[model samples]
Target: MTNAEPLFDPSLPGLADDPYPHYARLRRTDPVYEHPAGYWMVSRHDDATAVLRAPRMSVNEKNLAGAPADDSAPPPELPPAMVEATNVMNLSLLDVDPPDHTRLRSLVTKAFTPRAVAALEPVVTELVNEGLDRIADGGRVNLMDELAFPVPFAVISHMLGTPPADSDRIRELTGRIHRSPELLDEAELIEGMAAIEELVKISREMIDWKRANPADDLLTALIAAEHEGDKLTADELVAQVLLLYAAGHETTVSLIGGGVVALLQNPDQLDLLRRRPELAENAVEEFLRYDPPIQQTRRITTGPYPLRGKEIPGGSLVMVAIAAANRDEDHFGEDAGKLRIDRADARQHVSFGAGAHHCFGSALARMEARIAIGGLVDRFPSLELAGDVVWSDRVELRSAKVVPITV
Candidate 1:
């Protein structure tokens, strides 16, 4: 590992607002810097990829040091109810280990297969057009609220057979739960948990309803999936559905939001994409590399592992800074900081992650982004930013709370 000093604290304020600079420092200085937040931060491309792919690293919370013996318990300041709901509903394919993760992911992967996502292209295109139609007559629109957020939300909602009318409510609940970990005190955590409980209730009811009368949706698929002659239990079904609903929409929302911001900031890149509409796909890849939705993912060391001459004990936390890895000079070249839409190595970035936990819905997310972005430029050639951008204070997911733009 390169000997470099860590520039910014991952836990500092406004860090999420712009972490690329900090990531750059970490990559150049301390590639595997240890953070006081109780984790080793891997900022370099190769190091981050190694941690992500290493079998010794696990997503299971059980590996978290000093964590409650009951995996269902919330962290120190979190409310009990919130902890329980988080433990129950958050146990999707992302939070488990090999056999469990593999089994759970396999059961849901069929629904997100390339063919399945491709089939939704027309539908996604139509949805994008509809959203654009709403804003076509507008003076200004918050792209996140009006376009970016709704596109993925609608797509995922339809995939799960959820009514379009319920999208806003679901979004509110999930957004709260996602941001709860960043809250200052136990009270806020309690409120966040309450919101999560409500989400759980809604998800559970939906699963029950789907079970009674199955539909051709992902929820129905998960409800029907069997492993070793046994089907997913009610709790397992609730957990998986909730996880899908949150993960399926939230990250994509950020990608579209961040992608729009990236393009607007780099007019040259934006102009190039507009000129070569075919480059929409490449642009999406660049968007992911330049400004990924999910910035960091946590892993627990399941066994003693030697990384960059440091021996980390089992149960130690490892925070992989994906946003940093994408911009690593070693991986993307000296001009990595420059936005090159035509960069041949752009798709090699780790925005959707790598290895066993690579995003299953990456293709779907890309399809939505391509059609939505390409269609926007086609319909509104004069599209431009209308006001200051306001980003979410979320650490894990980087997104704009509001991106005012004009058609």
Candidate 2:
């Protein structure tokens, strides 16, 4: 399990079912591990936090110093259709560094501010109640479809003022494109690339329509958002809107779905939450820490990064295991593995990440989860698992694909 023994492969079977045990072993034996996949996996909470918060850490994939100037033929050019898609990917908020990252973030940061997100509480509550009503007669209903997906999807769609008619297609495309970041073979990568191209096309059409018809929504705000006499270029607007529209709801879907699954599996905590509904906010934090929506995030080293006694070389890819860090025994003590709704320091989890690249939709996601999950708990006093849970294959955005439940 330690770095000295052999290179580790994080894509081992059954990891999605439970990664904490593997993460625990890595934290104990090789807190800072260099994986054979040309990346470093940092499992400890302290190391993960340091790497995430480090100013030198980068998110740009171009920072990876590829094999020294190979004399082989240059790589083939991307298809014309893919060029636009690739450009959109390059301009993504998750892939850019500062100045660009700062600019892009500042342009829309106000929309996600706590005050702005608070204004959506009534909207979120209404959506949550509506979802509950849909599942009121439920006996073995799929929470993922009934509550998790619809709530966030509706919320983000409303925020973006996107056409509700296209939601089904958008969800499918987003799911396919999101698989690009996970462990994939050649065929899967090609499929993901195609998905990205499709999403970009769809997004462009949406943006074009939004322009002709402006509304008091996030998409309109992004369309008009400017900073320092700078406005988003047409392509930049498409990129940001696509990012916001896609990423905005994906994580919240995980949060609500995963949060519900956690409670169903931990009866005591569920009972406690039922008894003390006031702990809803703290319960959301605990859910994030116990089983984060995002399991890992990555950064590239701009310079030698030291952790424990090892020094990761410059230009190396570093995968910060946020899920592992959240459960680090040294950080959370012996009960780190257990879920406690009232865990005082649960908010300290790096689930939303740290530093400049922290998730932009955090406040919105929190509000959605708090309301969606809390409302469900309140509505169903006798809720229980109807069958075994089935988790999504996605490695980063962890969530149960299906949580069969009875109310």
Candidate 3:
């Protein structure tokens, strides 16, 4: 199970169900392992963190081995229009480099500040209570469908000024577009393009509507952002809005669902959380460390670089296994495999990433998880797993396809 032994294949089935064991073995044997895909696989905490924070590593796929430097270049092996569509939709701060990333992130950071996110605590509490109220008397409940999926969407929709009626549609589009790259084939890519186009139209309509009559929501703030006496262009506005919708919702959904599955598997941890409800905040941290929403993140070496005594050539693709890093015994002790709700060092995990490109909506996400999980336990003190849990096939975004529970 060493990293040199091919612990698990990204293309394999059922690997998502339990990747931690493999991750542990990799960290122990090969902290900086080379993969057959012509990239370095960083599986240890210190090594992964160093790579993520390294200036030589770039988030832009263009710096990668197979991607074009610009959108105008001939499309990659993707279907005729897939590459173009993806390039257009991926204009978020996540994909951009420093200056532009700094600019885009600054605009949205104002809305996601600690004060702003803290203010949403009450709103999040109410939203979670309402969702749990509907399912408290349920015979069987799919937590993903009934709770985990909707609460964050509702919160983001409120923040973005999207109508409540459109939440489900927007959620479906975001899910399809961000769930997994493997699920996206030629046809699915086209559908994803259409989804983004529809979302852009929706964003434009909202922008115009907000311009006519504004509110204190994030949308209004985004519409008001100006730099060097220049406001966001129509296309930039659409891209920014799409980024928030997808990232703000999908990742939080995965967090809640994955957290629940982890707690269920470790009833001792769940019981500890139940007994010391005040530990909810720290428990959320443990959840992120124990089973992060994002399993792996890809970057490219901007120049020939040496890591762990091996040379990674310029334009080499590098996959940082965040899940593996979180489980690294070097940082979290040998018992890192066990879930400790009150683990003081849990906050050191890179679940929300690190560096300038760290997750912009992290505060809001933590708020949502704390409220949702706390509210659930408060409402149904006897909650337990009602059926077998099922993880999604997404290798990049680790999440459950279905999570059933009973009270």
Largest lDDT belongs to which candidate?
2
- Give residue 235's error in model 3 in angstroms: 1.8
Worst lDDT window (10 residues) for model 2?
67-76
Better of 1 and 2 by lDDT: 2
Could you say which candidate leads in TM-score?
2
Candidate 1, residues 39-158, lDDT tens digits: the string is: 687888888888888888889887777866766445777667666777776567788888878877888888899999999998998899888987796758988877898889878878
TM-scores of the models, in the order given = 0.93, 0.94, 0.91
User: On residues 338-387, what C-alpha lDDT tens digit does candidate 2 reach at each position?
Assistant: 99999999998999999998887888888898998888888889898989
Cα error, residue 192 of model 2, in Å, equals 0.3
Clashing pairs in 3: none
Rank candidates by TM-score, best first: 2, 1, 3
Winner of 2 and 3 under lDDT: 2
Candidate 1 ranges beyond 4 A from true positions: 1-6, 72-83, 180-183, 226-229
lDDT per prediction?
Answer: 0.80, 0.83, 0.80
lDDT of 2: 0.83
What lDDT does candidate 2 reach at residue 228?
A: 24
Residue 323 lDDT in candidate 1: 85
Candidate 2 residue-pair clash tally: 0
TM-score of 3: 0.91
